[model samples]
Target: MATRRYLQLDVFAARAGTGNPLGVVLDADGMDTASMQALAAWLNLSETVFFVPMQDPAADYRIRIFTPGSELPFAGHPSVGAAWAALDAGLVDADARALVQECGAGLLPVRVEKTADGKRTIELCTPRRQALSTPPVAIPASLQALAAADAAPVLWSNGPAWWLLRANSAGAVRAFAPDFAAIAAFTNATDATGLVIFAPEAGAGHDVVVRAFCPGDAVNVPEDPVTGSANALVAAWLAAHAALPHADGRYVASQGRELGRDGRVQLRVDADGDVWLGGEVQPVIRGSLDW
Candidate 1:
């Protein structure tokens, strides 16, 4: 057995323990797919990432993301956490402001910067946003009951697909108690990663409240504390529908409070219609893994 570096990080958190947790294995060059899958299952987080050598010269690093049950082409928290891990491990230049990540979805650009308060933040540019033409899946009765009458559900793809819906208010989003089985069934039937419900918020520190349920066949996560991809898609949906509350096309999303965690995600839809998602990543644990 060889020893490898391991990092546990909280992604999109304003503080420690307030974001989605990710497991990262560094220098996992020779690890086979089965071994990576086994380790990810053992970690039992929403997703675990294995940092491998770059396959493309343009990429600064390559990562393989896995959930407990299966592998994903890409994921938000994992990508953010892996980038932080890479910087912390000296895999990339400490002062580097940009990086290109190679994954199943392709090479994605990442930006590292500091907030005005001097807090470190990482933002990732997601794949081209696509509103799929597939007929909308029937929303579960529970979700349908809570959905906003003014907005219809939409299916969005940016590597992982999500069913996006709007709620009447932030309170409704926070009070939403999902029927996991029913939602899971819906996601499976629609071949989506999860169902995301969000609502606009005012004077609440954040501009939007978001929640993601992923008890689907693709992954084992029940409630994702903070989801990067879903938030990105939400931003795109808002922009496309000309529903952006902010004229700047930027918003902060509040999530995970229903699960006793407070997660914040930063979202911006550029003039070119590119969605960028990012937030603070707090390092929780750094240790060695025996494999």
Candidate 2:
């Protein structure tokens, strides 16, 4: 039997077993594509991240993210989780300000932020581009499978994928019971592997609330706990449409309450046209893989 090491971390959650869980293969430097895909399928998390050394000093490492079936261009939770795993294990030094994570999408910056607790939070910067003038004119038929009588879907993107639905009321958002099979079919049909459903938050503390689902890749389940990227994209889309109250600073989105995995993510948008997403990743399992 061949022995390999892997680290599992619970991302976008303050504690373990709550947020979107991710598996990282530390010895993935020499593994081929077929092996990576097989390992991802075996781990069966939202995504599995593999690291390869890069020659450029500008970038510390080459990171690739994969689901059970295929590789992904970009993803928020896995990026956060993988970076956390790399740093926490002392694989990447602390002094690095910016490390370019090379993925299918291209080289993206993973900027490190120091938290109050002395831990690090990595914000993956998205490529600068103009937001689409308008969201999808109407909800797609697949999204309509989860739609209510009052609200339809809105298509928006940041990096990974765009949210397809935006409800008219808090009740409408909460009442959406998605058809996972239909969602899977829809995902297979489009480049988007995930979907975001949202509406205004009911309480006064936050601006809005939302839920995320990624049936195409990891955890073929519905309602991801905390989604920083989706919320950031949503916030940007909202800002473009002049819907949100604040023009600057960070916004927090809370999700996964209905699905039992309560989580939160903070999104920061600066005047310089840069978006920052922050979340916590807790190391859950330190184990090995024998094949």
Enumerate clash totals for all models, in the order shown.
0, 0
lDDT of 1 by residue, 1-291 (tens): 899988899999877889999999996989999999999888889999999878899999999999888898888889888888888889999878999999999999999996688666899988887787655567778887888998888888888889999988888898888999998998888888898999888746688889999998788689998998899888888888898878998889888989989899888888999988888899899899998
In model 2, where do residues sit more than 4 Å from their true spots?
Answer: 55-57, 95-98, 128-159, 202-206, 216-219
List per-prediction Cα lDDT, in the order shown.
0.88, 0.69
Q: Which ten residues in a row have the lowest lDDT in candidate 1?
A: 130-139
Best by lDDT: 1
Q: What is candidate 2's lDDT per residue for 136-184, written digit by digit as tens?
A: 3443464665554554445455556554566666676677777777666
Candidate 1: segments with Cα more than 4 A from true spot = 115-119, 135-137
The top-ranked prediction according to TM-score is: 1
Q: What is the lDDT of residue 29 in candidate 1?
A: 83
